[model samples]
Target: MADGLLVFDGYCGFCTRSVGWARALDRRGRVEMRPYQEPGVPESIGTDAATCADAVQFRGPDGVRHGGAAAVNALLDTVTGTRVPTTVYRATAGLQERVYRWVADHRGRFPGMTPYCESHPSECAAST
Candidate 1:
């Protein structure tokens, strides 16, 4: 079994692509990726739609929930088998949070960023 669950805004192209990259790095299958829009996902994670809509979430093996930059750092730790990312994240949390917020707010503004709903209309129909 995976060490944690990563809940992300699957509709966002950037988010989806980022998750794909993370999966690639997670050769050990340390994390399970899930779209927050999937049925019962947010509730199962003990979070709500609005909370998930705001930022990505990570539920660690210990069942602690982390959001936004913290979640990303935790995921990096799991996938890379090191605490380097966590150290960097903690050292630069303010800037990291700002950057994460900016990226989240403008996820669709980047070129070639097409949301999953557009790329896979059929599969995302219910979520949309």
Candidate 2:
């Protein structure tokens, strides 16, 4: 399978940890995980910083972009080599989106999760 790109917030510990799990699951190295904060990354993906900040982004081998819960489903499908994630996501689209949004909004509140901005104030000062 061609490599797929998973764009996420590097500043969010929760998001970073979640990407770590996804990396582990991608035994075939089929997915490329990139932080949206990286210079020129958002532009390369045909998106902008604000959109990426709002939701996780996935660009599959076919070059189709998926966001939020759809991004997660696409990543899972790529790593697992099954349609199950996509199937389940389609079945519960609304609920999936709501849950994803809630988690994203409260990601910093997760236990032991410290956003990069909080730790490195100077580095993230301009970005925020």
Tens-digit lDDT track of model 2 for 21-66:
8989999999988777777778777999899999999998879999
Q: Which stretches of model 1 miss by more than 4 angstroms?
A: 111-125
TM-score for model 1? Answer: 0.88
TM-score of 2: 0.87
Our model 1 lands, by Cα RMSD against the true structure, at: 2.0
The C-alpha lDDT values of all candidates are 0.85, 0.85
Clashes by residue pair, model 2? none
Per-residue error for 78 in candidate 1, Å, reads 0.6
Give per-residue CA lDDT, model 1, range 1-128, as digits (tens). 89999998868888888887899999999999888877788887899878998999999887989999999999999899999998999899999999999988897775435665566665443664
